[model samples]
Target: MSDKKKEIDLEEIIAKYRPVVGFRVKKSLGAANPDWEDVANEIMLNVVEKIKKGEFRGESSIGTFIYTITSRRIVDYIRQKSKVLRHAPEPKPLPSPHEQIEDKERAELIAGAIKKLKPKYRETLYLYYYRDLSRKEVAQKLGISLRRVSERVNYSQKLLRKLIKK
Candidate 1:
């Protein structure tokens, strides 16, 4: 293919995979930062440009390429933020004495209950419930099958219910 044709083909592939890239980045970064969508868009644009410039040859599928680039961007963003925070002055401590006391107490109770569960159950619950991951997402993150995620979640819920009833 001509250089221009190659560039166009890369752009078309990127366009087709944009939604998938956005969804993956949004899911991975949304909880950490509300500005994640903008970050994801910026990262996607950079990835497209790199692909068009022949920097990222299509050794992987378009979707995988976008996902890998987006993942790296997120990691780099987080590392940069951490470095900034490390160099910045610490913030003032809270002045209020009783802020979120009830919430903290409830959270402690729930955490104690979770600690009583099996390791797999606890991990599954923490990832799916506390981390707010969907079943499929949880499976993907944990490197488990979707069926295993479903089973673990169901079993964990039953175990928790039984423990709570006592």
Candidate 2:
């Protein structure tokens, strides 16, 4: 076997997919945080390296591959953030009662409802709502069929509504 590496045009690929990858990363990370662009660049670099190493295997389009990598990178970033929070100093106390009664009460109610959902339903809901993934993309990420993804999303939404009603 020859040792020649498949020469991919990294610049061309980057030019074509950088925006898409950045969009994916930004959507995956909730709009509350910074560093999404940096994460996108890191994901793109890793994807380029994987392509040159022949690890991509053309199972999906380069765009799809980049999206997948960016999604995982966002998840990794969140995990790292949680880890850092665990090691950091305790946060300061909350504001006064008058300030706390604004939108935070409604937000907490919704969050509690979501947490009460079944695991699979919660995962599907989070991927759809928080990650902003399409049904097909959710299927691809979760390794389920597109039809199943659609069904699960609909079912999960119903469950969420019921949970919130109680």
Candidate 3:
């Protein structure tokens, strides 16, 4: 039938589909995004290209095909935006003067707590943490079993945390 075999006219397609596509884009990608208009334009361009390439087979109505394309493009746009957000470098502004003072005070408090620990607990923490030795290495250096080394490290941390909380 000539009706089913009708030519794909992009202008008519745009006129009919623009509102729905724009609505879907705005809904899927929040209005807060400055690039929402660019995304809608990309979707329109893709729809035009696909039509010119004869990708529309008429197995479905033009409205359904356009709807599918619009939905997928919106998803792609959302995913791309999220991906940028996920990997974007966090801004590291300079710490304020009060923050610097607090950091110095906290370091002094922690150092005091470390000094109060028993010699073995203190040395084990130094070797494992300050020297960045593996538990096995610390055990070997300290002439103790791996389990003993682990216990001392854990117990020392717990004691330090309790002491610091005072």
Q: Distance from true position, residue 157, model 3, in Å? A: 66
Give lDDT tens digits, candidate 1, residues 1-166.
4788877876787677767777776786653454566776788788878876777666887667777788898788778767987889545444335745876786776667778998888888889989998988999988999999989988877887777567
Better of 2 and 3 by TM-score: 3
Evaluate all candidate structures by whole-model CA lDDT and list the values in order: 0.76, 0.78, 0.83
Q: Can you write out model 3's per-residue Cα lDDT over 1-166, one digit (the tens) per residue?
A: 3434334466677887777788778787765554666788888888888876778888999888888988887788778768887889435445458978998999999999999999999999999999999999999999999999989988998998999999
Residue range with the least summed lDDT across 10 consecutive positions in model 3? 1-10
Separate clash counts for every candidate: 0, 0, 0
Please give the TM-score that candidate 3 achieves against the real structure: 0.47
Candidate 2 residues 1-166, lDDT tens each?
A: 1333344456778888988888777787744345677788898889888877777777898778877787788889889878888889545554457856866887787789889878887898889789999988888888899889889878877876787788
**How are the candidates ranked when ordered by lDDT, highest leading?**
3, 2, 1
Best by lDDT: 3
For every model shown, what is its TM-score relative to the native structure?
Answer: 0.46, 0.46, 0.47
Clashing pairs in 3: none
Q: After aligning candidate 1 to the native by TM-score, how far in Å is the CA of 166 from where it should be?
A: 44
